[model samples]
Target: MHQKRPHVLGIDDGPFRKQQDGEVPIVGVVMEGATLVEGVALTSFPVDGAEATAFLADWVRGLRWMASLHAIVLGGITIAGLGVVDLRRLAGELDRPVLAVTRRETDGSDLAAALHAAGLSERMAVVERTPPAWRLERGLYVRAAGVEAAEAERLLRATLHKARLPEPLRVAHLIGAALVNGQSRGRV
Candidate 1:
């Protein structure tokens, strides 16, 4: 079969919470490939003042944009100190295979249950939990599939190491975070 640009979407979901409402979720979508497609930041409904169910509906609505995506690598915070963002709701929005990464400290079964509870259990892959220390320089993990294993590995490694952040998604982080921070500060 022929292939398109061979891209993967890496997501880093975050939330900002107040004393009363708890956590507010913000999603960052990063597209990694030759052209480095732009990343988008979206608020999943309740984050923007809508009801939770309605927000989930709106969040899932963005999947059409990723119809061409080959795979998705998903990760969210789980540290008790950091306060976790439930990613299963967002995962339900995706229609492709998903690799969910967590902290090495997290139990695999717990992670699976989390996704399953969110109704995304079928499309999930549990990756070895990587720590925040390692994530400082690595924004996303790139993978190449549907090709020679060696070739795929080579391409992924090259892209991941090419820079501290891949072109497409890094800008997404900047823009998305800026928007979130701006909104928080009442600047935007």
Candidate 2:
């Protein structure tokens, strides 16, 4: 009997300047069981206000490896400043599991205030509708749709190599940063 490796598309946005509005480059790395780099997708999305779910869903659907993908993982729920990626909507649209991983728990009140101040109050609703983050090992928090907490954890665990984060995400972060800054400097 042959066992199939888990294939995941992990997404992360490049570093962007605050108080500035523009599109931010993002990278998506596809991996087979957190070891092999299957492929990479490169794109950009509007910053601060434009929602990312539709853009991402359409982009992902166009990928050549879409059929074999086991999951879509995001570095964080929010990208390109205040732009929010709706997990539920993405999962429903793609008919596949979608998960977001964050290093720290968010401060809901602070985020709401920031969004309101940025004149993007509607973004708060997306945050509110998202399911709570489940704590993974070493302060990693995961929020997933189309999959339960246990399975989400298992998926993440199965997708990790030597890095603390999944290989797809880690590589995507490095690529995005290097593309924008000549070289990656900070932790993702």
Candidate 3:
């Protein structure tokens, strides 16, 4: 059987304020191969809150084109403070595989310590439940749900263009940053 090109939706959250309680903007980009199909935005609980999974699932479910998406890609497992993504819940709700990508290998110990310091120790369990990150290639690591490691790697390879990150993810990051800062900065 011939494999179809996956229509992937990449999600990312904008930067947030450090000393205040507020919502953070989250951006989702839908893409097929190198073509961008749609962009959607939502808000999540302030940094260190535990509502990312439910908020994301609800946002996705409300999209009219949700059924056209084949897989989901996230910029990271945490967004807007320490709101952790429940990979299993997201995948189960969408009935699609989900992948979280990071630019560097994460130090679990450091993350746990930070969460503890932030009074978000409860988030550690959710973080621990995320599948361990696997190196998709040099400078790229990923954790996935509902997809095999090899297949995830293949999808990443196929979707990556000039950067190690997937195009949809890069676009989402750029859009998210621009919305927050008026101008985008950092490596996309």
Candidate 4:
């Protein structure tokens, strides 16, 4: 009973300025089972903006190898500070299950305040629509779109290697970090 390992495309964003509009590098690492297969990079607006979802969707749609992917994994639910990703829209655009992974539980009040301050209060509805983050093994948490929590748990367990973060996301994080800073270090 040998089951084929699923291929996953993991995405992550690089560090950016908090106060101004700037370009942040977004990296996507494709993994077949535990093996790294491909990597792609794109840019998105700074924190508390509305460009991550469309940029990600367009990048995924343009990738010829995307058809082979079983799912999409994100390092976090937001990029460039408070620029929240619309996971549901991304999943619908790609027709693939999407999972956003985080190392800690998020504070809703704090997020709301930030959105309000940024004049992005309307974006709160999108965040509200996102599935709650579920704790998986080894202290990792995840919110999924177009995929069941149980299935996401199974995939996380299957793909994790060397750290709490999955390999694809880990690689993407490292690449993004290196691109922003000269080196990649600390928890992403």
* Candidate with the greatest TM-score versus the true structure: 2
Better of 2 and 4 by lDDT: 2
- List TM-scores for all candidates, in order: 0.45, 0.93, 0.90, 0.90
Clashes of each: 1, 0, 4, 3
Task: Give the lDDT of residue 12 in candidate 1.
Answer: 44
Q: Compose the digit string of candidate 3's lDDT tens values, residues 1-188.
A: 01345678888888777655777788888887655556555555566667788888888888766888878899888878678888978989888888999988986787788789888898888888888887766678899998888888776766687877887888888888899899999763
Candidate 2 stretches greater than 4 Å from native: 1-4, 186-188
- Superpose all Cα atoms of candidate 3 onto the true structure and report the RMSD in Å to 1 decimal: 2.1
Best by lDDT: 2
Predicted candidate 4 versus true structure: per-residue lDDT over 1-188, tens digit per residue: 11256788888888776785667777888887666566555555555557778877888888777878888899877877787788899999899889999888885677788889888898788788878887887888899998888787777766687788888888888888899899999864
> Of the candidates numbered 1 and 4, which has the greater TM-score value?
4
The ten-residue window of minimal lDDT in model 2 covers 1-10
RMSD of 2: 2.3
Put the candidates in TM-score order, highest first: 2, 3, 4, 1
The lDDT for every candidate, in the order shown, is 0.41, 0.85, 0.79, 0.79
The reply for model 1, stretches above 4 Å from the true place, is 1-5, 15-25, 30-35, 39-41, 45-61, 77-95, 102-105, 108-172, 183-188
Better of 1 and 3 by TM-score: 3
Badly placed stretches (over 4 Å) of model 3 are 1-4, 186-188
Residue-wise C-alpha lDDT for candidate 1, range 1-188, written one tens digit per residue: 12344565655434354332434445546565645664565653232232332343355456555656655444433321122333433344544433333334333466566555656454333223322212222444322222333443333343343445433334434554555576322122
Model 2 C-alpha lDDT per residue in residues 1-188, reported as the tens digit of each score = 01246889999999888887778898999998878999999999877757588889999999999998889999988778788888999999998889998888875677788889999898888989888887899678889998888778888888887777888898999999998899997654
lDDT at 54, model 4: 87
Number of colliding residue pairs in model 3: 4
- The RMSD of every model to the true structure, in order and in angstroms, is 8.5, 2.3, 2.1, 2.5
